[model samples]
Target: MIETIVFDIGETITRDDRYWASWADWLGVPRHTLSALVGAVVAQGLDNAEAIRLVRPGIDVASEYRAREAAGRGEQLDESDLYDDVRPALTALRKAGVRVVVAGNQTARMGDLMRDLDLPADVVLTSGEWGVAKPQPEFFARVLEVAQAAPEATLYVGDHPANDIFPAKAAGLRTAHIRRGPWGHLWADDPEVVAAADWRVESLTQLARIVSA
Candidate 1:
């Protein structure tokens, strides 16, 4: 039985529209331009942040991030950012005796924002807090450590195949490929994704049923 279910943040639980829109505004570009650039880099298997570098060559993204915070326009999150199914699905899982965890490639501030939302998760963690991001064996190792469960009994759910499905599966955790984000939709039909994912779900509600079965 799947005793624990771990989730990715962007697109899997929350839509990233506001996040990207804020970046585009800060960079003084039209929202659609940055959105297109993000999709282009993602399609080319490059990091999404590459879009910023593409817009302004040789710019230090970290420094700009700090600048934005100093300007009072840093990362922001609220219940509005969450997907419609997030609360119901996570609550269902927890009530069903499953441990629901929210861990993702997000900033430490994002972690704080997520916890403030009061989602029905047993734990909320982020790459910034952990000092390790996904697709890294060490990150998944931390996940297993926090789960305190056998790898086979823990399910890792995310939208990215490369970062979430492949690596989590390699770490011996059951992987669920959620088809909602840019990466998710792009790779959903790929043969490799199909092979790596133990389950493919369009919504978290489906995941509730999956674990129940």
Candidate 2:
């Protein structure tokens, strides 16, 4: 039985509309342009942040992030950013005695913002806090450490195939490929993703039921 369920933040628990839109405004480019570029990079298996670099070559993204914060426009997260199934599904899992954790590739500030939202998770962590990002063996090692459970007893859920499904599976956790965002939809039917994911779900509600059973 699965004792712990770890989630990816972007496109898994939350919609990334505001994130890309904010970057578009900051870069003075049309939102659709950046969105298209993000999708392009995601398809090509490049980092999504490459979209920003495409617009401004040699730009220091971290510096720009600080600049945006200094100008009073940084990362923002609230109720609307969450998927409709997030609260109910996570709450249900926790109530059912399943350990729920939210760990994703996000900044330290984003982790604080996530905590402020008070989602029903036992732990909320970000890559920025752990100093390691996904697809890395160290990141999954940290997750297993926090979980305090055998890898086979934990499940990792996310929308990205390369970052979420593949590595998590390699770490011995059962993997669920959630279909929602650009990468989710684009790679949902890919042979590798389908083969790697132990479960393929469209929504967290479906995931909740799968776990409960």
Highest TM-score: give the candidate number. 1
Per-residue alpha-carbon lDDT of candidate 2 for residues 1-213, written as tens digits (9 for 90 to 100): 889999999999989999999999999999999999998998898999899999999999999999999999999999999999999999999988899999999999999999999999999999999999998989999999888779999999999988999999999999999989999999999999999999999989887787768
Alpha-carbon error at 205 in model 1, in Å?
Answer: 0.6
Report, for every candidate in turn, its global Cα lDDT versus the true structure. 0.94, 0.94
Q: What stretches of model 1 exceed 4 Å from their correct place?
A: none
lDDT assessment of candidate 2 = 0.94
List the candidates' TM-scores in order. Answer: 0.99, 0.98
lDDT of 1 by residue, 1-213 (tens): 899999999999999999999999999999999999999999999999999999899999999999999999999998889999999999999999999999999999999999999999999999999999998999999998888789999999999988899999999999999989799999999999999999999989888788889
Query: Where does model 2 exceed 4 Å of error?
Result: none
Give the Cα error of residue 90 in candidate 1, in Å: 0.3
